[model samples]
Target chain A: MINAPSPTQSPSTTVPGRLETRGASRSAATLAFAWRTALRIKYVPEQLVDVVAVPLVFTVMFTYLLGGALAGSPSSYLHSLLPGTLVMTLVLLTTFTGTGLRSDLSSGVHDRFQSLPVWRPAPLVGALVGDLGRYLLASSIVFGLGLAMGFRPDGGVGGALAALGLVLVFAHALSWVWIVVGISVRNVSAVNAINIGVQLPLTMASNVFVDPATMPGWLRPIIENNPISFVVTATRGLMHGEAQLSEVLWVLAIAGALLVVFVPLSLYKYRTHRS
Target chain B: MTHPVIHSQGLKKRYGNHKALDGLNLEVPSGGVYALLGPNGAGKTTAVRVLSTLVPPDGGAAHVLGYDLVRDAHTVRSKIALTGQYASVDIDLTGQENLVLIGRLLGLGRAGARRRATEVLERFSLTDAAARQVRTYSGGMRRRLDLAASLIKPPQLLFLDEPTTGLDPRSRIELWTLVRQLVSDGTSVLLTTQYLDEADQLADRIGVLNSGRMVADGTADELKASVGGGSLQVRLLDHEQRDTAAQLLGSQLKAQPHLPPDPAVVEIPVIGSEAANDALTQLHHAGIDIISFSLGQPTLDEVFLSLTGHPTATEELA
Candidate 1:
């Protein structure tokens, strides 16, 4: 075993000065943590199977399985189905963020981060930022595969890009909901359970796969007014060159409101929550 | 007298109805290792957490590196690093990445962080595994990397909570050597351990904690001396003669012999070398055939048992 120190070694008792310029800024360090988290998908490719394979499988299955019944033909349905599937797939991927955060919290990594001198919110903020990549990846896969399966947007490239931007912004804001759940929940499995409970109902109840006009009179209002419905409607409007300023604004307003409430709520829980 | 590197008085914390830490006081002078030896659930980890600013204490006051733990927590955080009982480095990141991340968080610039990562990796003999993910590392390598991560800036003080809890003997010794080097270079370490030998081997001063209180604090020798000096242990060849041996030694040494769970062994405390010799001579003069007799200094185990009336939880489990 290691023993006493040798006499030749000098005891350097000088304390270094406070590092004024040496440390990275809070935002920069947080981004670095986020980047590292996203980069971990490279080592564990199974993480990507959800973003890559799920969107393709769901879009193909739903587009073919329900296309004739929901619309006149598969080609006509693709126009609406592709945009709706994009929103649904991106929303589903947000749950992984909660599961990842819960895992980190339970594994004692949070304790290490808590004891560090860095700003307390960096880990949570960085995690949200890192998950942006997953959201983007899922979006591209759904869109790219839609193009391959003979679906074309009436909206030009710019309109399609705009729609993608809106969905991403909405998904980004919606992530705070999961982030809050991630921090407050007891475990990863619990976070997954709660997120699925919230996500599945929102996706199914919205106008994702079918037009609300064909639904029962009582269900039309709930489906048409669902937040997911607003996003899917706005995205379809933009992608079909039928964009409306009010629908886009409504989506933005909801995204902004989710951000306003849940960001602070998640931050508050991040600061106070302990295991 | 120089101010202690760490000082706490009447520190208190409770979890619901159970007291995790109860009016505990501690002092550790600068430039050496101070080992807090206690059993599981004795509040050693709680004390470390409170001092390291991971958890706030419900009552009392503490100063670490001359800064108040609560009010001046930022200053204390800047001056200290903690390696928790678990290897807290990111498993997904490479060992080098873990160090660089900590370095950058500690305010080392990008280039500076890289340089420090390289240097600490070399110091811990982890250069070979620096590029590998920590998830692939053995327990010892991960621990070394964990310690290395905490040293990114070499704080004035470090908190090592059970640094060698599950390490193999060689790795344990290597960590001890590294700690000794760190202490020699003027770093103050507040280490908590259930292993008595670890404290005896590293601590310049040892503090015995039981039920969230410091029951004794002194150098190893002083604590041993307080427990009535060294002991003479005699083992009889025949189990039938054990009672006769205990009685004979009890009378010869004028002290009650302590019988551990084993029946063939008798342990008597002796004042000095002469008394030890007297006991051995008296045993030899008797008709009992001795299988073995040895004069030895009281180990911290005995000191711990004498002070607490029971072995540490780890020892009990062992």
Candidate 2:
């Protein structure tokens, strides 16, 4: 049973009814929530498995299994395989954010957040910002594994860093789409199902693992025009120091369009749905 | 006159043909606990949500803390906190971290937030488990933390929706004590509960909600008295003697004697001590052996039954 605060240990100065006025600006609070989300990974260390161990395993397995037939050697295959794996790994991790948001809704945390005096979209935006850490960790592991396995980037350190920045921006923008799905879906499983359903098709039909020209004629258009293809090709070009402006612009345009459509859509759905 | 902390008129909300709240009105004064007692689906939670500015009512106006609910929702939100039916603290965060996060969101600086979190943790006796994630805390501990979080910047009014619904006896008593402490410090609380005894224990005034309407509202004694003066419960030694004793008591009291599911007991409504005495003498003269007899004021359940034509869902479940 709870007891009254003893006079000797009373901390009346910080009690309720004393403090007035909002404490932090909307953006600052959003950032604070983002920081809190990232901090949760510290307690649930298993969250790192998707970003760290999965990337290492995928890179090693793919490089060893297909490298001999496709690129003549494992080390040679990593030049192309690493960037594709990075895109696949980062994209897959975004589903976790959607599922996380769905669970937050189910568990009533979303209601608590909505009732607070903070910015309405802070929770959603903060979640996206927090997820950037996972994307960064996964990218670094893929790149580092490639380097350790005798893969080198001709685009030098600056080019490699730029490619990373582009991938992070793209992943961040793509998360808004998932956030919209998260808000609209009925359950966490549905969110995961929809996200995986959309992501696998986008990734496989793109020029990630194999050359678009080698694919059958009917499948060539999808492989050539796919947005993931644009991102992957841009990343490869940047990391190889032979960057293409058209492909980079295409990736940027797709990211901008996704943000423009989904951010407001998510906020609108969040406002309308009491649950 | 000073405005009440919460005032609503003709509050109406509907969910696709189901009227959660219909033409309801409420007035809650400052600095005391006002309990809204009702069964499930009686619109208690809906009323709380509307007053707290979480759900907008379709056809009513409300002022919470003197701010119009619709026009100045941000102001209302800043002045009120709601601890809902479910524990709303983040399960992934430690108890201390949950408080700190809410504090920072409420506009406190990092250091100020940490200091406030520490104070709340200590006040709620959660300092020992402050570093553990909320998922690991027991139900009582989680509920205490939920209440503590609502007090991070205590508002003038607090809304607790079924705050002790699933707690054990000891935890329920502890929460009742904490609510009393909060009320003593001048926070007006509007609570909803199905526990009749809970309302009897904590509320300065109680409102009985039935099917989207305020069926009755008064202090516990007043509401109980409204049902009738009192009730006399008679337990006969022989189960076979129940019908004759009930017949004699019913005619003497000029009221129906209620036969409960138990075969050995009969309950009679009495207007006063004189009525009870007349019935007792009548039973003795009829050679009815009474093992035990007691006269008591009507309970809230009886009041609810008289008003709503059915026992409260909690009583039925019990």
Candidate 3:
């Protein structure tokens, strides 16, 4: 069948000026990249695994291991654990942005993108948006599981929802750093190795497992100041209805600072790199 | 002369210590096909990439469709489309979806994008496979889909980098026919290829690139002229006649004459069709009875060999 222009359609606009044409094409490229990235999520949904498993493991482990030690009872500890799982899920799911970007680069997909008339920001923005779906899917599961485990946020519904929102922004902001890693490096396995290898030190150095004040001198400085520790701690505080504006600001500050630094670097490398 | 659609002056690209495009210059008119023929690593793909705004050149200036190479990249990109050596379609998407996505990306409305997608698919004879995932489609099918995607916006300039590299002979011919028809409709195409016959059949002008430089370029006839124009081959009924013919033609034609092992054949090289005709007239006047006489034009392969002093390498379609 010969598919022709629809009856309702008039002539396509041919805008004057070279700059206008370029801008229009770039916009089109951005939309195409976004659609392609979104469709890819359907086939390879590895982010789901990270989002669900990480939060579930952390929730179960923390409630069982530290519940009696910290809260005097597993039931009491469970009441305040929902916020930690929610934040952790978002963080875990967001890290896949790097992995996915690296995979695309290694698999000839990036080369394909390079050949197009795409805007410089399209791939970066598309990848970020695509990973947002992962964050949402995983965060909701953590929330549902938290509810099933008897963990109720002392914060009202608005506070609880606001906490979720904070996690999403934090995750997206952190995604920029990994996008740099993905774009610069060609090996996905190396990305995974580096990410997984560094994560333990980072997690242990934070306030995830124990109270920061209880640590020794040198370790206490690093652990207390760690970003993830602040996120988890602030989230825990938010769930208890004790909103810490300072801590939330700290998370936002870190996210914003990373975006300021890494986004430009990624774009610069993207524009200059030889294919 | 009318202003060329593409003009390059001493374009150069380097990879660390290695130069990929070395002091290259080219000019193509507003329409028809211009094929860049080269061996492996000769920089055909690099040239295309640089012109398409996908790869930056280390030196030299190029104006593509009247837009500056570096300053007017966005403008150049808007007017041009590239179908790379490999199909650039998203394999996860269906064939139709890939084209529609490109159409929409090119600023078509949702309904318009869908219509354009269907139009291109039907044009490429891909309507039957429109709904199938590209990953499941055959290589030739994906190649056609990729070409269709590039044409969705009806770009004035198209860069087809080795368009039929991995295709079956039949599919290759089909694509060639389509490409020819596109050129006929006023689209200018720059096709880079290693397939000599592909250049011979498709290009209005063929530029033979070697070692990051254009060693020779012109219409197919001009390329052939570089290798002594044309020749005449005769096969006699006996070996003595072949020897006598070679001897007679050698002194008269001012050209090389050779006798094969079969001994019944003789070949005479000439500068052009006129010289070939002159040789035939001289041979008949000399009472040399020839069983057969055939004129031969040098192939692109021979022209490449003559220009580069080596066998033509494949175009490294990176």
Candidate 2 error regions (>4 Å): A1-18, A51-56, A217-226, B238-263, B268-289
Clashing residue pairs, backbone N/CA/C < 3 A, model 3: A28-B105, B39-B313, B39-B314, B40-B314
Q: Report the C-alpha lDDT of model 1 over A125-197, residue by residue, as the tens digit.
A: 7887888888787777787889899888899898889999999899889888988888888899898787567
- Pick the TM-score winner: 2
Model 1, span B1-318: residue lDDT tens? 778999999999887888988989999898899999988888998898889987788999999989999998877887788898888888988999888888777777677778878877876778888999999999888888888877777777999999998899888987887788788777889999999989999999999998888999999999998897788888888868878888888898898888866778889888888987877777778877778888888988889988877686555645
Model 1 chain B: worst 10 consecutive residues (lDDT sum): B309-318
DockQ winner, 1 or 3: 1
Relative to the unseen true structure, what is the C-alpha lDDT of residue B85 in candidate 1, on a scale of 0 to 100? Answer: 87
| Cα shift from native, residue B26, model 2 (Å) | 0.7
Across residues B82-194, which tens digit of lDDT does each residue of candidate 2 receive?
Answer: 89888888888999999999888888878888998998888777899999999999888889999888888887788999999789888888888788878877788999999
The model with the greatest DockQ is 2
lDDT of 2 at A16: 43
Of the two candidates 1 and 3, the one with more favorable TM-score, higher being better, is: 1
Worst 10 residues of 3 chain A by lDDT: A8-17
Candidate 3 lDDT by residue in tens digits, B39-141: 8789898898888888778999999988899898867777788888778777878999888776666667568779877866776778888988889998877
| Candidate 3 ranges beyond 4 A from true positions | A1-32, A50-82, A99-118, A199-205, A209-222, B229-296, B309-318
Q: Model 1 scores what on Cα lDDT?
A: 0.82
